[model samples]
Every structure is written in C-alpha cells, then in structure tokens.
Target chain A: MQIVREQDVVPFRNRVKEFATKIGMSLVNQTKLITAASELVRNMLKYANGGKILLEIISKNAQTGVRLTFIDEGPGITDIKQAMQDGFSTGKSLGLGLPGAKRLVNEFDLKSKPGEGTTVTVTHWKNGR
Target chain B: MDRIPILKMGQFLLVTIQVDLYDRLALNLENDLINMVSKTGARGVLIDISAVSIVDSFMGRILGNIASMSRIMDAETVVVGMQPAVAITLVELGLTLQGVYTALDVEKGMELLHDKIGTIEHPEDEEEEAPHDDID
Candidate 1:
C-alpha cells in the first residue's frame, strides 16, 4: 500500500483492521496494531513525504502475527537512537511516533541511512507472545 | 473538502464525530471548534467521539489542543464516549490527555458540563415567560 497523503491513512488503517480481524485478533490487540501503524504512516508522510507499506501475515507453529513494513525514500534519520527516544521530534509533533509505536507491538525494527531512506517494520501477535 | 459540523445547543457547543477523521478533518474541526466557542461565548463544549475507533498520537494531540485552547477562551471542554480499546492505546502511546475532562457517555458529559458551568439558561426558554401565579 502507498501512503502519499493524510487521506490515505484512514483507508490503510481500515485494511489493517480487516486483516487483524481475519486472524481473530482481539479488539484491544487490533486497536494497538492499528494505532502503531497510524503513527508510523504519519511519520513517513511527515518526514519522507510519502512511503510504501507492506502488510504480511506470519505464522510460527500455531501462532499467527501481522507484520507491517513502512518504506520511505525521503531524507533518512541520521540519529536513529535519538529518534527512538520519547519527546525527540524534529518536527512540531510530540515525538512519540516512533517509540510509542514500539510499545504497542510485539516486535519492532527500524533501518535508516543518511541521504538515503528509512524503513520501519513492526509485528503484533494475535496472542501477544 | 470534507468538514465536520459543529452544532450549538443553548450556551454550549456540541460536536459528535461520526466519521473516521483524517488528519486534515481533525485539524479543521479543532480550528472551527475554537472559533465557535469564541464567537458564541459558549460556557461548555461537549465532544462525543463514540463512533471514532482509532486515536493515534496526532489525534490525541488535537484533542488536547482543543481542550487547552477552549480553556483559555473560558469554555470548558469535555471528551465523552471513548471506546475501551482507544483508551488503552492512548495510555500506551504516552498521551494521558492531561487537563482534559472526560466522561463515559454524552448524557454524563452533559451533566458534567452543567456541573462545571452551573445551571444552563436555554435561549429559547428565555423567550417565553413562565407562569408566576404560584410565586408569593
């Protein structure tokens, strides 16, 4: 999915919700997944001007999880460590986008290169393992 | 181009967010709501968000901003009908919505507004005189 504007956020969230529901994720877990996705998508738009999101469902034995990867080709983060800290935003936002999204999911991974682009991948398990 | 309507009830402003608000719509609502409060001198502002399911950090900030702005303008803002899932997500997102009053439902929100601002005077009621025959 391509996220190029603010209007794209709602439809993307609805798609994620549908995917999560298909896997029988709980309401709370579904909300968390959708919220985390919202933060990451907004960040991509704000910093990178737009991005591509990949939604995948992974299974480990009998457990199932939803994974979302956000890829942006805009200006990459020079200091990922600082970016992960709470209240550390280059924009006028509250700076909870990155770290807050991490707290809501089971797994979080971020990769960025200066003068290149950024990629953020997150996963939420149905059973919250 | 989509806009959320802000309704005025007596001395209060009511906003029931019935759609999944995009960022622009949310921002527009914040701007329009403050203007309405300032223009009408409304004593209280009730926001019913029962239909909204997802509230990320941006949405959270908008709500907080509305409350703070309304307070400075002498209007109390109450956010009501937050879903349980949304509440949990908000707390985890580090947005506690400080200084913003909240209620479980619209009716309770109205009661809280009345409590905060005292008895409300309906503009329509003031147009007609109540029978004074029983008074003294």
Candidate 2:
C-alpha cells in the first residue's frame, strides 16, 4: 500500500501508468485509469489528510484488470447518495469529484460512515467496453 | 522557488510546461500568467503541454481558471500539444474546458490566436522574420 498525499499524486499516477502499460493497455485506457486514480488519491489527501492505496492485478474468466482501493481514516462522508451527485462538492471545485472518477473506470464501490472513514474501490478491465 | 517562464512573443504570451506541475506551482503559474496578461496587454496566450503526461481535475481546474482569467483580460488562450491520452482523460473527467482553445502544436496555436485577435501593429515583423527552429 502506498501513502497518498499532495506530493504523491504524480508518482502514484506514474506507477499506475506503468502497470497499465505493462498490461498492454492502450494509451487512452491507461490515461483513464491513471486519471481516475489521481482523483481518488487527491480526495484521500483533501478530506482525510492522507491515506494508503492497495494496487492489485486481478484475473477472471480469461480477463485481466487492475484494481485500486483507497482507505482513509478521517471524517467519513455523511450522504453517499448526495455526494455522488454530479454537482455536489464540499471543496471549492466543480464537484465532479466522485462521479467523475466513477465515470472513468469499469467498476466502482464506495463505502463510508459518518465518523469512521472512507474506502473507495475502483477497477479498470483490459479491453473493457 | 520554481517558476515557469512565460515568454512574450509579438502580442502573445507563450508558456510551455516542461516539468511535472505541482499544486503550488500550478497556482503560481495562474497568478503569474494573469498578471502578465494584464501588464503586457497581450492579445493572446499559448500554453504548450506536450511534455506533460498526466492531468487530473486539479490541473484541469487550473487550466480552466487561467483561460477564464485571460479571457477577462481580453486575451485569448490556446492550449497546445495535448497528449491524446490526456484529452481522453479530460473528457471522461467531465471537464470540457469550455472556453479554452486547443491546438495540435505551438505553431497552430499561434495561428489560431492570430485568427481570433487579428494581427496588431508592431514595430518589427519578428513573427515571420524570426527563425522557426525553436518549435519542436
């Protein structure tokens, strides 16, 4: 697990990019995955101070994909439904944070509590439509 | 203290980000670019991001802010040499960068800016007469 912070954004994206390239992912696909990762990591830093991410390569039914789980132990989200809305943001931004990241990948799972923490898991499948 | 240099061409300011842009650096660039646009009365601006590999929402917002700020200053902004991957990522992120213009390269970006603002009166025809070896 790699710690996610402000300075770690670029390096985290680079590591994800390398893994995507190694999996024979196209440049476009690689960018999408890395971009998604960038958003999640930044969220971890912004809302949770800093967190750790688990990177994994998974296979099922002769298919391969990359999975990332972001775990943060800060003040958790109160309303997951409203937070996933396209234009809702607690920070000074366009509020495309969670939804935008979700749009860039194949699978997304977000679990959070009021005071516990937040864990967001996302995946990108190779040649996934 | 790292600062990205903004070059003043005939009537346009050129900024080529050759290194990874950190949060502070990006914010600083925004402030500098806006100030430069106002002080120089530049009609157009071209930002080359060919060397940049990754762009997240923060970087996307910075670009958008720079373009918007330049527009308010009566200066047009053109982003040049965006990698195909970055472009794709941006689209997925739902950041169309609505007001900013984009080009395949600096030369084309310059030309686009010229088309938008038209040619201004200058003492010398440095644009056409100057050597074009720097555009790679």
Candidate 3:
C-alpha cells in the first residue's frame, strides 16, 4: 500500500519497473503497465486522498505475468460500467483513462464506491510463451 | 530551452516540437501532435526529442497517431534528433512508434523536408485543442 499523488507517480513507475524487470517483462508490456499505473495513480492523488498500489509477480501453470493492484480511498466512481467506455470520463481527458489502460494489459478489473474508495487491477503477461 | 519556432520556406512550413515528453504529458502531447498534423495546413513537421530523456508508451501512442494523421493531412512528419539515451530508454520502456520518418539533425530534417517542402501552403491554422496550461 502506497499513498497516491502526482509526485508519487515516479516512485510507482519505478516500483513497476523494478518488479517488471525481475519478471523478465517485455519492454512493450512493461511500458504499458507503467503508463497505465501512472495515470491511475495520478487520478488517485488529483481526485482522492493518498492511495496505495501493490505490484507483484504472478505465475500460473507454465505461465508468468505481473499483477498490479491500485487502491484509492477517494470518492468512488459514479458509474463503474460507463467508466470502462473509451469516451466516458469525469476528468478532462479524452476519456481514454480506463479503456486505454484496458487495451494495454491482459486482465483488467475495477471496483469503486462513491464517497468510499476505488480499486483497479491490471495484469500483463509475456507473449503467451 | 526556448520554444522552437515554425519556419516557412516558400509554401512549405516546417515546425518543431520538442518537449520532454514524459509521464501523462506524453499522452496529451501526442493528441496535440496528431491534431496538429490533421488540421494544420503545414506540409512538414519536425519533432525533436533530444531534450526528452525517453519516449514511453504514451509517447509511442502519440507517435502512432501522428503517423496516421500525416496520411490524412497529406503531410510528412519527420522525427528528428532522438538522443541515444532516449532511444535506449524508449526501447527499455517497450515503446513502439510506427510510420514516422527519422533524422539525425536539423540538416537531415531539412533534407527530408526537401521532398515535401514544395507542397506546403500558408500556415493555414493553429491547433484546435484546448491549450494545455503547462505547455507554453
């Protein structure tokens, strides 16, 4: 668990980089996860109080990948389902936040409760090798 | 660094965009770059990344968008002066850029400009996106 903020993005990205490196994560995949995490963490700081993110390596039967869980105790999403749409956003972006991140990672799961907290999980694996 | 000004030779306009291009700024810069390519009347654009420590996934997305919009705008976007460290970092970051022309320096950028320079018209319009307050 780590507090989230704009300044924390660097550390979060670095954390992902360190973990991703040990996992032999591909360059493209690593960048995607880092970028996605950075954006989410930024949101956590901008919209919520500090949040914590957990980065871990997961290995399944004959397969290995990285798992990142970002949790924020901020005002939760107004709509979980609509937030997944590309053009839907409560922020000033092109509404590419959640959906764009989804395009980059293998598994994406998110839950949010208004006035409570928000959590997003994304996992990236090697090329099915 | 002082902002690089857009230059005009005959009808062709060559503009330079050199931002650190990191973090979330990378994504917005990409969108701006793409829109500049599509809507601007310029014939050629030279993007210098020497100041950038690295180009990441967000930057990669922008580069792809620029290439796609270049075709739509009937213009050529040449990427210039990517530092070795930046290139390495970009590779390590696993970023990918497609359909972009690259040059080593302004001279080389000019050389690439020679082909499309003659097709340039007046600087027809500026970007339409809401200006990012941080970028000046």
Candidate 4:
C-alpha cells in the first residue's frame, strides 16, 4: 500500500508509467492508466484526509494488466450509483472525477458505505481489452 | 518563489513552462500572466507546455482559468505544444479547455496570435525622414 498525498501525485504517476512501459503497454494505454491513477489518488486526498493505494501487475490467461485499488476510511459515498454519474461531484470540481476515471480503464469497481469508507479498483489491460 | 518567466514580444507575452508545476507554482504563473498582460497591454499570450509531461485536474483548471482571465483583460491566450499523451489525459479527465486556443508548436501559436491580434508595427519599417525619436 502506498500513501496518497498531494506531493506524492507526480512520483506515483511516474512509477505507474514506468511499470506500464515495462509491461510493453502502448503509449496511449500507458497514458490512460496513469491518468486514471491520478484522478483516483487525488480523490483519496480530497475525500479522506489521506489514503493508501495498492498497485499490482496481474495476468489472466496469458493476458497481462495493471490493477490499482484505493482505500480510504473517511466519510464514504452515500449514493454510489449517483456518484458514478458524470457531472455529479460533491466537491466543487468539474464533476468528472469518478465517471471519467471509469471510462479510461478497462475495468472499474467501486464499493462504499455512508460512514465507513470508499474502495475504488481500476484495471487496464495491456492490449486494451 | 519558483515562478515561470513571462517575456514580452511585440504585442504578445510568451511563457514556457519547462518544469513540473505544483499548485503554488501554477497559481503564481496565473497571477503573473494576468498582471503582465495588464501592465504591458499585451494583446496575445502564448504558453509553451511541450516540456511539461504531467498535468492533473488542478493544472488543467489553471490553464482554463488563465485563458478566461486573459480574455477578461482583453488578451487572448493560446496554449501550445501539448503532448499527445497529455491531450488524451486531459480529454479523459473531462477538461476540453473550452474557449482556449491551442496550437501544435510555438511558431504556429505565434501565427495564430498574429491572426487574432494584428502584428505590432516595427519602428524599422518607418521612413528615415520621419521623427528620429526613439520609442524603445
């Protein structure tokens, strides 16, 4: 688990980029993964005081991919379905945080409780599957 | 006080960001660009971001804000030299940078600025017989 802080954003992105590159992911796919990672990491810092992220390189049936899971024990999302909608941001942002990140990755999973916390998992396959 | 330098070129202001900008540095750039536009009466502002490799929502907002603020001050802002990866990332992040002009490179951005705001007439183009007063 990696700590998520404002200062950690750039270094995190760089590390993710390096990992994606090492896995032979295309430039476009690498960029997408890094971008999604950036959004989720920032959300951790914004919602929770701070959080931790777990990065793993996974493979399934000879297909390789990168997976990132963000966990925070802050005030969790009340209505996840609504929160997943674009232009639906609790923060005074452009409201594209959740939905935008979902679209950029191959797979997305989010679980949250009103008072417990939020866990976001996203994965991007090397071949864009 | 780490700040990007803003140079005056004729009727335009040029800024090149060669480093990764955190929140404070980005905010300082926005403030400096606006003030320079006001103080110099610059008609166009060109920002070169070819060297910048990473940008987040905050940085994206700063770019948009600088464009809007320059517009309010009667100056046009053109963002130039965005990498392909950065473009895709911004689009995925839902930042289209609406109302802000963009170019592939500095030369094209300069041309675009000249189109929006006419070029500043050079004193060398004036006749020798005219007043010998120095404008610089």
lDDT per residue for candidate 3 within A1-129, as digits (tens), equals 576444566656778888888878776566666766665665677678678888888988767888888888889898888987756768655465677677667888999989899988888886523
lDDT score, candidate 2, position A34: 83
**Candidate 2 on B93-122: residue-level lDDT in tens?**
898988889999998998899879977444
Candidate 1 is graded, for docking, as: medium
RMSD (Å) per prediction:
6.8, 7.0, 11.8, 7.3
Candidate with maximal TM-score: 1
Question: Ranking by DockQ, best first?
Answer: 1, 2, 4, 3
Better of 1 and 2 by TM-score: 1
DockQ for each model: 0.72, 0.65, 0.07, 0.43
**Higher-TM-score candidate among 1 and 3?**
1
Compared with the true structure, what per-residue lDDT tens digits does model 4 show for residues A90-127?
88777777888898899999999878899999999998
Q: How high is the lDDT of residue A25 in model 3?
A: 78
lDDT of each: 0.94, 0.88, 0.66, 0.86
* Candidate 3, residue A93: lDDT: 50
Could you give candidate 1's per-residue lDDT for residues A27-118 as a string of tens digits? 99999999999999999999899999999989988899999999999899999999999999999999999999999999999999987899
Candidate 3, residue A30: Cα displacement in angstroms equals 1.8
The TM-score of candidate 2's chain A against the true chain A comes to 0.95
Checking candidate 2 for backbone clashes, the offending pairs are none
